[model samples]
Target: MHKASSDTLRVSVVVPVYNRPSELRELLAALVLQSVDSAEFEVLICDDGSTVDLRAVVDEFNTMNSLQIHYFRQHNQGPGIARNLGLHNAGGAIVAFTDSDCIPEPEWLSELIGPIETSSVGMTGGLVDFRTADHLSGRCVNYLMSSMLGAGGARDPRAALHMRYYPRAGNTAVRRELACAAGGFSGQRHGEDIEFSNRILQMRTKIEFVPTAVVVHNEKKNSRQVAMEAFQKGTARIRLAREQGVHELIHTLPALLVVGLTASALTGLFLPAFSKIAGIPTVLYAIVLALIGLHGGFLLKDVRALLLLPFYASLMHIGYGAGYLYAFLTDPSTSVSLERQTVAAKSPHDGMSEQ
Candidate 1:
């Protein structure tokens, strides 16, 4: 994923911003200096109804004439809908997406679009590295949900997905046509990217990995934020699980609980080696249980925060469980609706269209 700055690439950068004022400002600053030719690119910044005044944030980038940058304000409809609106307003054949909290490398867009142009792939995604340990837990949870959420994963998690790739909605690109054809992000608050990726994979669309298209996800060091994030993520996971018809996520808790209890009970009666091994997972399981018991209300993913690795994973399981229960009781059907209006294309489907 070498940078392609020689030729001008017209990219419609879509960023969905919320209340994060300072971060958004930093992101805009980074966008201002991208290795891609600013003159050839356009930016559509959708304000996802921030409670705070973000005018200054947008103002920092809006005054620039080097690139066409515009701002749209929408009531909080969650990030999915916010991004979908940006998708509708984009003007470049190549649509690049990133979160407001993310800081893109100078070559971010160039590298992402470069591979897609060369390979003629319909869409692509990139890797996200957290900035600090204060975000380790939330960051780790992001890793766990990556595969299930269509955010892209290492051939193995142990592989760390560090090898360069694409498919994640955040920090990724799509052929404007492909996004338009499949419909845009669902209005749901969560798992919209998962649904979109599943649609692409189901269609056997060619998606490539551009390892060089990297972004630093400045993860939340705040537990409350992490907790709320977890809750929302839980809500989304449940919705997506039903959508995918995968019910195992819903039952993971009871099953894990049973495993924990059974392992605890059986450990004392088993031979030494077997007993220790049985106790290990059980001990880890109990650690998760204890964390939730102690700080179930908190949200940050850092060590001092409420969600630890095992506990955060467990909380996610709980959220999915509760989400599944609610969905099953409400709508048992996970069928995709044909009525889903395809996202109206604001630009040509250069990257997503068949060459």
Candidate 2:
């Protein structure tokens, strides 16, 4: 990559880190290999109160690559706050956000920046994908997320037939001034990216979704972690809806499936004939998931991964459903009201766009 003066910089790649020095190293290495000129872009690593000293990792990269890398340290607030610090300190006109665990493709920065610079759009985003499945949980989650039944639409805008594409921090770029005008991220731990995107929408800022700007997410979580992520996503959706008034019916599908399956199983225990009828949903769901798993296995050449999909799918759906129910039923109005208060306390200009 060509190196130029920092005065000519066009993009600021902001990554928030939290106790993941090794992952941060990998991401920094990938950033050094970006197709964009090294001087055209700079990196700001915002540490979110990590117990492990991450400065060494950033310093190592800076020395080895002679890259324009800056590091900031803050108390353990959250990713949103850390990102805001990066944004505030960034000097580039374009600000790109990605996670510490993601490794961007060579063309990732170039691809995302081209659209944002050439067009009238205020923001652009790319696909967050997995190149390999190292573990069973990764395999299962990757397979499910890549399918139409899962978040294929979310990962690729062309496939978003029913779902709308939102700019996630994991692979998104925005005009720095526009983002600042929109009040930056809202500091929500779970769905801050989506919440920030909603504010961008309120500004009527056009966002382009570019599928080629790929970032390989190095997610190596166990089954329990995967389930917990889904559960948190479920709750986050509700919180976002309450705060942003952006609701999607598709988010409730898993919860509905959970309720239906539970009711059907209970009814089947009392009526033997109804048991056969009740088994249809479960059977069909299993068969479809199994088929998806088989397809994944065929593509990856791993039969063991195929066998575990159904169980993983069950965990994803049930955990998400339980979380959705818990959030929705646990003093719904009070949570919404309190959330508003908290947001107001944190940042007065968070969700409001410049009028």
Candidate of highest TM-score:
2
TM-score of model 1 vs. true structure: 0.71
Cα lDDT tens digits for candidate 1, 1-355? 1122313546789988888888887788888889887767877778888899876666666665355566777888877777777777666777899887788888898898887677768788776654232246545555444432212232113243322222666778887778777778777655567677667655677877666787877655443554455456545555655566423432345334554656566875776667766677668767655554343223333444343545555555544445444445566566434223357754432232210
Which candidate has the top score in lDDT? Answer: 2
lDDT tens readout by residue for model 2, 1-355: 2244436888989999999888898899889999998878888889989999898887788778767888888888888888887777676888899999888989999998998888898999888664363355665576566556654355566653446678888899998887787777766677788888888888998988888888877768777887898888778878877877767777788888888888788878988778988888888777867776777678667777677766777777788877888899885885453121122122312332211
- Specify the poorest-scoring 10-residue window by lDDT in model 2: 340-349
Count of backbone clashes, every candidate in sequence = 9, 0
RMSD vs true structure, all candidates: 8.0, 5.0
What are the TM-scores, per candidate, against the unseen true structure? 0.71, 0.89
Clashing pairs for predicted structure model 1, backbone only:
125-166, 125-167, 164-211, 175-352, 177-349, 223-299, 223-300, 226-299, 227-299
